[model samples]
Target: MANSSSTRGTSLDPRARRTRALLRAAVLDLSTEKDLDSITMSDIAQRAEVNRATVYLHYKDREDLLLDATESTMEGVVEAARACRLSVDTHALPDATPTHLISLFAQVDQHRAVYRQMLGEDGSARCATRLEHLLAQAWFEQLTAEPPGSPHETALQVRAHFLSGAVLAVIGRWTRGDFDGEGEDGGGGGGGNGNGNGMSVAEVADLTWALIRGQK
Candidate 1:
């Protein structure tokens, strides 16, 4: 997630941008097809139709490129989390799950396979840590934006950390098929008809929101 390649100025050449895009696409596609540890730089280069040296020019290593490719997919999740009204009075919150929350889960659902691999037991620690950081930062911003009576800074930090951890755990387990039997889709759910688990997008969202709000 701390790739120097990503920090390059917006003025990067068009061809460079195209090359980076191809490399990212290649890594992401390969991730869904095999275990990440087995994907080498040469594998990505071949898939992207670029020379091995070209891949090195853009990314320091395979992990750097993999993170860059996966980072783009979390933008929607971050935005949705930032927009959530986490500070609202529990009684006043809507009975229905917020559309933003649903969108957050849907965003993850769309990239389920990649996420499943990344957040699994054998997944990348960098990827998991980066996701947790982004989620905590998003929730922290939203909490700070609450009107005058918001919690103290330390309290906010605790809440943000708690939220991010909880959300990440839910997402990881969901993606790993831990919840495949929780809904009507039957055991071992894999079809996109649901969230790739047994629950629908909204159902999972509601469950997550309920847990966030400390409801039973």
Candidate 2:
């Protein structure tokens, strides 16, 4: 009992937590402001006010650091998604709507650099995969009331995975500024903003849910 408490307390120590925050903030700040190719360990150290050696101790290379940063951001998104699920039941939340989802997506657009980096040539598909996994886990916990082998379970899981991927894909495109006529977001072949008005996350969310549920 003593040992377990000691371990837990150590993990919660202030200085140790601060060091991690510094390193994580340094990586994300640099990523947000510059392309991944241009960032360096020394640059991160300087931005973070830490030593290069310290950075090395926490991460193996630029790729590793970028991955770590991306995961950190996903934690919040996953939580929001989980909340979306809970809101559906605990509060008799209204059916998922496109407008609301699109608005959440627009918030993601606010971090174009981070999303772009995740989908860019130098970025890690692994980060995207893990994020999808998180979203799937949240959805599964809520959407699946039966055991895995039930008649409808497999189908639902597949649909969940597909929905998660679609969400990520749209966000990826948005980050790259590819929403053609999609307001300030990029667009190479994007159709005019949904319904010809300014882009909206709520609309996208509604559309996405429609697709996932096969609704008209």
**Per-prediction TM-score:** 0.89, 0.71
Instruction: Give the Cα error of residue 161 in candidate 1, in Å.
Output: 1.2
Task: For model 2, give the RMSD to the true fold.
Answer: 6.5
Segments of candidate 2 deviating more than 4 angstroms: 1-12, 86-107, 146-152, 181-198
Q: Pick out the ten consecutive residues of candidate 2 with the lowest summed lDDT.
A: 1-10
lDDT of 2: 0.62
lDDT of 1 by residue, 41-141 (tens): 98999999999999888777778887888886778888898888777355766777899999998888788777777787788778888888998998888
Clash tally, candidates in order: 0, 16
Clashes of 1: 0
| Candidate 2 colliding pairs, count | 16
